[model samples]
Target: MITFQVKDMSCGHCVSVITQAVMAADPQAQVQIDLATHRVSIEPAAADAAALREAIAEAGYTPVPV
Candidate 1:
């Protein structure tokens, strides 16, 4: 499981986009978003933080390690 900070996530729409982005990179990944804290937690089948970060970036959000 990897938890990262996405300071711009502030709404349900943002969550949806981020979820979709992560899923695009790793379909089996489990994504959880906490808008209140601006954090996204992902439990991926494999360890690929860089891939995940790139996915988030492609989604239009900045991912910072927690």
Candidate 2:
């Protein structure tokens, strides 16, 4: 599992985008987001941590590994 702190993720839209990006990167990825904490956790089935981070970053958010 990988965890990231996405401080800019504030609403449902942010969560949706992040989830989509992660799924796009690894279809089997399990994504869990805590909007209140701005935290995203992913259990990637194939993608690596770096790839997951890049996917989130490409979605226009800063994902700091936690």
- Strongest candidate by TM-score: 2
lDDT of 1 by residue, 1-66 (tens): 899999988899999999999998999999988999999999997649999999999899999989
Q: Following a full C-alpha superposition, what root-mean-square deviation does model 1 have from the true structure?
A: 0.9
Cα error of candidate 2 at position 14, Å:
0.3
Q: What is the C-alpha lDDT of each candidate?
A: 0.92, 0.98
**Lowest-lDDT window of 10 residues in candidate 1?**
45-54
Model 2, 1-66: lDDT tens digits are 899999999999999999999999999999999999999999999999999999999999999999
Alpha-carbon RMSD, each predicted model: 0.9, 0.4
